[model samples]
Target: MNTRKRQLAMTALGVATLAITAVGTQGAPPAPPWFTWTTVVNNGDFMPTDSCVPTAPSTPPCRTFNSYNQPSVNANQVVVIRARSRGGQGGQAVHGVYTRDMAAAGPVVRILDRSTLVPQPNNLDSTFIEPPSFPRIDIGMDTVATRGNHQPVWRYFLDDVTETRAGTTGVYTNPFGDLIAGASKLGAVPDFSFFEVPEAPGTPFDVFPGAPAVTDGATIAFKGNYPVNGVGKTGVYYRDLENAPIPLSADNLEPAGGSNPVVLIANSLDTFIPGTRTIFGSTAPPSAANRQMVFAGFDNEDKPTLGGIYLAPLNGTTQPPLRTLVAIGGQVPGENSKARFNRLGEGVSFDGRFVAFWGAWGTEKKTLVLQCRTEGNADRVAFCNQQHPNGFITTVPVNQGIFVHDLGTRQTQVVAKTPADYDDFVYWNFSGRTPGTGEGDDDGELARWRSASFVAVSGLVDGTLTDATFHAAFKARTGILMSGTYAEPVDGIYLREGPGKASLLTLVETDMDGSLIDPEAVDDLGAALPVTEMGIERDGFRGNSLVINASMGTEETGWAGIYLTEVPE
Candidate 1:
């Protein structure tokens, strides 16, 4: 075999291998073996007016479905998400407005038609966007109830849709509701529909429905936690769609209020914010100490005596709650040189200890990985920490702006960065190394397990728009789906396929690179499923690269919605 002939033969073989297709479950189109794509939601056609994106008469039957897209046609999983900026001083987003998204796998996409109360975008000065969910979904929306213009305000919608005290309900994809925070809830309508969480549950601060997955086919899984103070507020939680109004007044869930009485904790409007969260130690509950690090507060206003790492043991069935933990960002005179801190976007991990956050304190322009030692009242100081661990083949900020931090590493890698002036996002994955248990100790028995890996990360840049951007300017995202296959953000959808793996997947787009309408469309189409924005877990729908596009005047009608495609391999 001559050199040229050998090369030609190998090339042909590769092409042939790429062409092989496998039929997904229940008669889906034949796509590449072990690889499938699907559409979960497509509300792009809905009119932009009305509190809920008007469910205009459409050919695709809008069936009522679960927002937390669960179930899998095969090994792969997915979710479609949409959102519009709040158009206020800061570009804050209100999510979880739509009902269920269209789901596609292989060549088959299923869209559920239901009377969903989608939120109406202000359309004033915001960008409506729809992205795909990989390991889990992160969606929430808000609604405002005002008596005319000058009247008193009533209810407020986070996603700008659900009618408070009226027809407002959260749907989840997980089958059995959880015992922790009400991250999972049944829909107001559609008897059995479940709503996926829109915000990321920051562990060590709070725990909600997270790590969404389908086990044993019909069994859906999400994270659950126990609240500390009666007002300590339980973390991002899940309400078993099957077990609404769960009778969980135990120390495990809500820590009974009175002498072992359950505390009635309320979740905040920002419950579903995306970022990294940690799981409490295996030994929690029963003990009154801080059982977990489900939630943490961000105090950038002023530097305090104790860094903003809140820690207050729960009083006996009698005492009130203790002080909260905090870490100030910026210089604090004679304080430690760590300076002030800034929390990257919000999200979480399974165990609820170690966290990945970004900060811009004096002098240091970098990221940090803060860790907690114990769970519950025993939540001592951070024991293990890994700051801004990157998994790129080249020397780059592996995973910048840490969003969702997990204990076990996966096959995710950071690919590329976006150019200036472009809309860019970042993506993270659990790029499993050949030897999963190395890096720290040789015994492979170091403190439970080795929670370290060379993460595969990527970012996209635009061809136009050249502006200097600090590393903090970009953000990260992730989503979940039925099959459990997580889709971490990559450079573009066109990137070649690797072996399927990951618990969560999300796309992180960078901000402002000259022009990036085409790639954004491509990435959008590739990352999203037919159904979007309503699942407990999300994946792959992430990356940090961005392409700037021509501004759409406020004349727009519809709010931003995530869209995607599943091309034939």
Candidate 2:
């Protein structure tokens, strides 16, 4: 919605764009611009309404709190927010749809269709996740079993939400219907089912199946599949939404291990190429590339870990990967490299050529968005600078200036350097990484990016570091990608560097209600929005790129859900 300009205009794409603002005319009040808001899903009812042009002193913003988790829509334009009623609920709950301008009114909202995405049945747990389809959601839950090689299995449900939250796009639905009611067709391994675990004795296993229950209002998702190199996998896992999983096409479907990978994306959606190859050598077609339609898990040998950014091909993927960029890959944390999770943060170049992985381990140890160059070399394995921790050489802050790596020349230049860390003059400071589309970001033709920043952690929460999303080329305009501390609401926003790299973020100011990260702010990076999970959705979620955070927990209960936000362009 390029409604940036004040003049009302309609593009060829039927997307209505009009800036709304309120102002007072002495004793006389004039309406601003005519606008329409559709209450898609919420606690409200289906009642199309209208409102005169808002007459406030600033721009008018509308909020649609998540009523469903992994809210998905179909080509029929049906938007469904996945959800589950109280604990004792059964089968799929309400699934709402709507037309345009359903919320022209204030409170009451309307629905295009008011039917559950799927009819109640044998407790088919639909794990919601976004595929490569635009504005369309896909089910990460599995419908049938195939050769998944152990990657946290997932099947396409067309639309809905999953459990796991935060940066993890893969998630499982609560066990519904009859306990032990499912087919183990593929030889019967540890696969998900709708049968709710029994609470008493061994009746059926308490609560639902799978990991511990996610926290309320926390967005989470599953991380890796089976395993990678004998390491547990990680990906964006989030809860907290009324829906299931909302695939974050930017972070590269990866779970937490504390660090950035060495991959880049050319699309803002999941894309995958089987680890296996075809007898023909060229590999298989896109459809056959998945090998397993549902992601059950990955090879246990390659247990997934955080960003250990290395390069490996699917056992049977395409001959030459359509794309290659940094992604989570490591037997464990630190990847035995200088980059530790504490200072991990990065950016990828277009065309999957170069990667900017940053991290700062020790004191004299500053942040470093290590310039990882991957010039279409699939065999190229990313090796971190050993001098990282003990203070080898590279010492850039998460906000270091003029940081750009030119692949053509294989050169790393830090154009801008500050006296020292922002906190203390004796130390140097820096940062980088914008939440924009990692796709098509060929270093040759870079577009948008973010500025990673760190706040001086103190007291109990020693390392209270945060990442801010800024524009590429290190510009400080407005909007920054930063998380809020439990103390403050609306954490932070995408920052657009000014003429001199000065920041002008939106959340800090527009947060009229005090705090509560604005759900709308997640869409700053073009159609790419910050999601509960991490990863890239190059092909409708079939291929995800992100890191899994195993140490993550929820706001109230134990660890749950994943967290992600848009990077400013």
Candidate 3:
């Protein structure tokens, strides 16, 4: 057995012993109060047949969904997600964006899918390749916004023959109406007549990276990239859709001004990095609520120590300057005066009053050695050996922690940290397939990494800063190696209520009963499958509802799905 499996086996033995002793002493403790689990959607659930389109002879019928991305929940208990269906459609994977009203136990409704027509200018209909991940919904409303990759529609007359351009991606939204039937084109690229980069007049957007965020007021905030003077530029921008024309009818084919003007929030070339002398080199996708936006900015893209999170007000007549919420060099709360943040993650959770984020500090480091699990694939074995001649790869670890910053009070609260509440806050993995004998693909996951913690906050939204009732939900990986044996790390979602509270209530964790994921799922041995993996993006928690994606099973058989539960403050 590999090191990980061996460690799991040893940990299982210890846990079994503890369970027997606990039953004899305390006759089993009360179940966690936060686990009122409700299944949102699961793998193998049949998708809407209407979404399937037989474009090619090899195209098969769209059947059950096989995978899901992180989900987002709104205050109404509505969840918006992006999922993929595999196998049945042999030609290509069928991808789509969907929403469900968890409060009413309603059926899943499709917003858009690969077969759906891409609403474009002048009725130049196109089809989407896939709906990008991280589809978002407004907190107070159901306005959904996402980035869509579609067929290029920009056409030119070349030698009298119509030729289409290459650019084919842009931000889109479903305005406040029937999300499915009312979906319309919000903004798209290569069509300068309809969309242009703000401030860089006449320059059309090259691409919109990341999922767009929608406000309750129908304002869309996104990070857009374009070229200016033959050089590339990027910024975070927003467009007010309340007055913008909707392409729901032929008469509203285009905006009155030819193009809807997107207001610039910040850009890499001009926006000053708060608390630093250098300007912002880049900005992450923003989170907006209650007419305010929160985003992380970096003065040095290559250095995490030069980054911080800022809040920009969207209600002001003039673009208000950004207010520094936290910085990399800022003193960490409850730590020594000398302790300062050395790293800040790009993902943040903002609910108007509170901004929950993760950062790293301290000088202590942990090294993780990774060896490829070849699984008897000769190509993988050769690739791994060639990549790591020493037989292993190692990661340089830093101290990590999660924090909640109150915009009203201007106070920061440390929720959890490494070596105290968990072992590590981030993990690395190899992604993509091994290359063939020839040249290799530039897949992002060769040594890709992701943080284990994605935090969200819920508190009184009474427009007051003094409200002390703040609840934070974050993902954590705990357990550490002691002596020569490794204690299997427990990946879990936890809730920390109130500011500076050290105690955290377990919301969900690995090795828990599979009933929490799906009561009917079991392994081949006829026993409940234990929870295996959990996933939550930055926006997974909103209001009092926390939604997450989980995988359950034993080594042989398993299932994955999305689950929702209440986190009472």
Candidate 4:
């Protein structure tokens, strides 16, 4: 046993300080044979009638699956997802992109849906109106990049009958073969132009926001924006699908020494923001591996206290200057030394050499309120008391920390924090909008809070950097149950192993006990349905496996699923 007595026997069988001694111990907590769990697809199951399902209420296609997003895994355990169904046949909404292998239990393949087929120099008969709510996988193969929202397929004429312009959205791949018949098309956003950006050319990338990191040599890494005369620039690119150059038409563009895209960092270009002379006014959305890349920047994209986390190097020749790992005034390691870092998190969890991020320090807040009849509807509790004359709606709390860092020993460590080990890493709710109207509604907001952590990190590909064998896994919530004060929060999915050596084992929480979530699933008071919500994404942990998305009983014996476990060595 050893890693601090197997993290104190996994903190006495799954931490949360053993929820009041596991409320009279009866289930969950004794699973340490080496921890197994699996169940990669759930929410009424059924799908696969040849993928994407669809066909409405019945007939050949079937349907079922419901929802899921946040799954990636691939050190060969495969698993890549982004699902949504139930509504099919006519109420549309089938959405797809799937994969499953978990060492071959078979079934769940499908990659790309909405009836698949938008790969042509089109005329608006597109397919794929969705597939980018996280769908990546390639940490050493099963290649699966994604970013697809269809419909425009690039074509512009205007004076000669043939006009289509709406930036078709792109980035797709299947590279290592047979992942749903070798998927395809990997770059679009009107296929680069305004001279293709790279050293600085600017203008044609109407936006490609998230979902696009894939390396293990298939190289994809993305985040583009482009506006130019109306401001908005943003960067961080990369293409190299094993060498680029063949995209010419099916409206996929790139061809002329492979249409640019290898920039790595943009916004004003001098890049800066490490020790700060202030430069990158924006970046985030990148986390590749082996070909290296990790992002998160922002030296003032309208109020940012410096900015941090970098590391770039796609290795395509000249272009090598970003390497800082954590920086926004630094300090904040285990805290107090004047606790620095004023905010850093924009999703990071690289694996090339451990990066896992989330940082925030001081400005310590805590307001909360929230109560428009528990979350509106009487026209949002009378527009939340006509915009707060006090029916309730507040929110402040967000002091975070969840670090890892170690770019070959630059060292950083601390994997959880906020009021010294959990109290509020931000979490509010009640955004039953409809009150004033969307988008920050004149600041008298109705409620919205998030920063509930979310991390990943794994290590030891070849070990050494003082190899104690990393490992992270996150998604925290904790902060309540003061014995007699009674707030009782909990929420979980934690792992942490060799960062200051063990003590956060949990692996699933929020009233856990539905037979530790599936030992036959009970709940009509035959108890055992607990677990309410857990999720984890920043490419949901890989290599030694982690992959979550859960919700357990009651919307009528509820269940929602996607789970995989394995971390014990």
Candidate 5:
């Protein structure tokens, strides 16, 4: 997933319901080929606020459903950021919120309806910097919270809300009742103070960098930078939505018990903020009886040490138990600089036992594959070393490798890549020379393996054989669903059932008739461009769905729209 998509998935926070047209499950056996494509929301059917400039004269001034939207989902519903007002010629677009029920039958519902007012010049000083009078809503992760009576709660960040440092003359009074040091109104709500800038002598940090994760129990845990009053301290703070925001890795909770917080470990540095977290438990309607959180902290603050992933319990305690499942500096030579956890995001087993993540070992002719225990608070770095003293299962020319750490055994296993397969696979555009080539620079690397043993690796790579032959062989051996122009059609999303051939997952061109909106209601209703980007939900109704952002001919042709799809169970 890209940075923007990752942020959308992580930042989503809210609870709203919409009408859904119930599509019956496949009557035949549940398997591949049983997949069905249903349109959640297309243009025309999706209504923007009245403020948007309308394309037709008889129609009210409005904008079409924006293509730049990001979507989030739970077992029962899907939410997205829909733009209502289109900026005419050189104007700015206005946005609104929308949702759809996965179980009911109806059109997409607009919870925060858009305004009908004409586009106005932006007042940068106002809560909303743009023309829309509504707050700019950025949706993040969504969860089915039982605490709120099984309601669907979605996480979101609102821009344009007032955070006045000084009271106004009836124009604005602090809605939060209390005030923080900074006067910025860009943060989450129902708990807005969590992102405010504190006064001097306190850690005046910005909003949570990474997004928050919500559990089925209505508990939310996020990466936040908080400053304590009278204490000059700063670090990523972990807060649960059930109570007041408290620092799980605060300065007081560190080994020194002051400004130097432990950062979710026995003795870790304070530079480990801006980390990613994953909350795991039983299937849908996750049970809190055995829920847990796994995360990786980075030394972004430039501490003299390398960062590692940590695990903690969410048993409703003020300070739940925490430990260093994996730390820096091990048996591997120069591991401090060579090996690093897949920091893109966190991934945990359904039962919250084993956690899987990729470890990049740099350009060296080796892939560092390691794991640690998540079942206990014991230090497992020694155990991990004992299992693989060389710091990896095998050495291969490939830099990207997957590893799974068994929490129970406290042992790590290399799931992908081995010395035996060295030079067996080459990245896309491989000239059969140079170690790392062809889109090798990892930025938004997304490697997700579903409930099955197979995984979909982004980017194209060939082996000693043709691209098709290489992909087939690789999938047979590693269960990796990989494809490219040499093996499949170009400019489209495709899914493969390992051990066989790849199948197209999406279309590069389609008419507007498939859209949920009326035929005459929209102009240039056809969708163009191919699947430019895609992200498979790692958990939470992810087994059957995936998200993609697509575009038409160009920006003038209405450039983007985010869509969600479901496959056979």
Candidate 6:
């Protein structure tokens, strides 16, 4: 198994032990509450279907499917992508994208529905096409996207199963669950799209599943496998959500032997689409702003060069100037001799000026920095030093931590580092496990703030880490929502403002008393709030509003639901 997979396995094992006895040893005053909880869409609710009325169209009635996956929000509305059963017809489950105000009266309106979209062959190639329905939507399959300028709008890219013939069934499917060809697709190009989301039922757009389009006058920074000489080619493409899509990274665009662009996203919360709002702060204004996008790409062959992150304007022809932000190998400027970003981290500032991600450095590199314990091995001299004898052991101040790059300054700074002392270990919850959902699996993604000043990262960080310096640096920051792990006395969600203090907000599940206990209300940091299984996944921010998916019962008897917790400014 790869390093990340191994760490997750270890995390799962740690969780097993903690579930038996999650009791806080010492007591402290309750920290102030930072967020107010609200339920956006739960599994039990019936989503509206066949709601739109196209000027000239007749689509089938909508179907309902449980399970809410993606949650995105803007100043106006919160949108979620939900799947519906095909009623057992056979092919795949259909999906719909809906928006709401958190308190809309009737059934939430679904903007895009499977019955409304029909896959057609990409005119350029007879075989290549888009996924015909929502059952084919897979965000974890490297299909990441963003709205044009992070505005609430239509989707720019999406994927689904391919049709058999130009309009038939029986297309080839892959392990990733995407249809490859239209009965006769040639080459390895996967079924994908770069079109707009259909505005009304029966008004089909060419692209596959994508984030909402750039309705708010934003640009689109999306990734897809477009056809090159009839063969599938992967690259980062930019569009203003107006004209055609432009390739930022593609074959022949990079120097000889260079690899394709592998863009980083804020998190694995949804398909790699830009949501309506940018989480990190940006100086770039709305006017003429959708012209550029930031991404990571490698132009060097042979050495696997950790690659360099690049930015390009949407106006450029051929390939824009490939500005290298930070590269791992080669004589590249800003190259970190000790570490390279394997898979780029997520969350870019609005202006495309700043980017935040986790990095791999020395032998101490980790997919989840929370795994780097600091207690007995507080110095990290044991495992960390063993991993990088020449790097962190001798030179680097901190081995692996979160870092941010300023496109304007061309500089990278460590936002937070693994504690050098065991007493200062950061805590994250690993108890929110969902078998097929890939929930607890994504333990430590970078949670960035809209101001770009502070970031809320996951892992098992407890209340003890709070100190004078921690508070001063993080006090002004919000959006730190992490799962409570076995490392703590309880397994619940914890909220903190800045780094001064953390409050045990609620448990993954209610306690034995059958009540969702509030630790703050009880004035006890380790108060045993009652609840049953309620582990949360994809807990993140849409601007300052937080969205998460939680399962109410164990996998056998529980159901998953989507929630919205508004952060108080």
Best by lDDT: 3
Runs in model 5 with CA error above 4 Å?
Answer: 1-35, 43-45, 48-59, 80-85, 89-91, 110-205, 226-234, 238-291, 300-305, 316-319, 323-356, 365-398, 402-529, 535-543, 558-560
Please list the Cα RMSD from the true structure of every candidate, rounded to 1 decimal place: 19.9, 19.8, 6.7, 21.9, 17.6, 16.1
Report, for all candidates in order, the number of backbone clashes.
226, 227, 0, 6, 29, 54
TM-score of each: 0.31, 0.29, 0.81, 0.35, 0.46, 0.46
Q: Whole-model lDDT, candidate 3? A: 0.66
Candidate 5 displacement at residue 271 in angstroms: 8.4
Which 10-residue span in candidate 2 carries the lowest summed lDDT? 280-289
Which tens-of-lDDT digit does each residue in 1-569 have in candidate 5?
11111011111112122222211233532122222335455444435444433455234544456444334444333533333434462344444445565546455654333232111111122122211111111112233211000011122334665443311100000112121111112222223233333222222233232223444333433343333444433222322322122233321111111111112211122222223232211111111112466665444322213545566676544334555555433222223554543321233222244444434444455332333322211233334434445433333334443344445555544444323222222221101111222111111122111111212221112211112111111111111223211222122233322112222222211221222221222235443232222222223223234444344333444334545555331
lDDT of candidate model 1 versus the reference: 0.23
- Model 6 regions more than 4 Å off: 1-33, 51-65, 84-94, 103-107, 119-219, 226-232, 241-290, 299-304, 316-318, 329-343, 346-353, 365-399, 406-413, 419-540
Residue 118 in model 6: lDDT: 22
**lDDT by residue for model 1 (1-569), tens:** 01111011112113332221111224533232221222333323332222332343333322221122222111122332322223231222222223232332322121211212222111122221211222232211111000000111113333558654221211123223221122222222121122322232211222222233222222222333333444333222212222233232231222111111122111232222122232212111110111323233332212222223322222222112323222334232223565333432223221122222332223322232222322211111112223212211211122232222222231112222222111123333222111332211111123221222112211111111122111111232322211322233112122211112111112212121101212222233343111111111122222222111111111122112233323212
Please identify which of the two predictions, 1 or 2, would achieve the higher TM-score against the true structure. Answer: 1
Off by over 4 Å in 2: 1-40, 45-224, 227-490, 495-503, 507-569
Predicted candidate 3 versus true structure: per-residue lDDT over 1-569, tens digit per residue: 11121111112112221221111134654233335788888865766656444343225454666677789988788998888766435455567888899999998888788777765442456677666556887877777887776666444444557664544666667664532211222233333333666566666677676667888646778887777788877788877664344443225543322244677888876767765677778888888888788988887655665768888888633345888899879999988999998778777888778889888877666656565544323465577767766545344345778889987788998887766667666644343346543111111123322233477777742223468667777887766554322377677777776675535566667777666457765655666666777778766777778888888863225777788987644
* lDDT on C-alpha atoms for all candidate structures: 0.23, 0.21, 0.66, 0.62, 0.30, 0.31
Alpha carbon lDDT at 87, candidate 5: 47
Worst 10 residues of 6 by lDDT: 1-10
lDDT tens digits, residue span 32-138, model 6: 22334566655445556444233322344333445554454432234344444434423334455554555353346544444432212233222211222111111
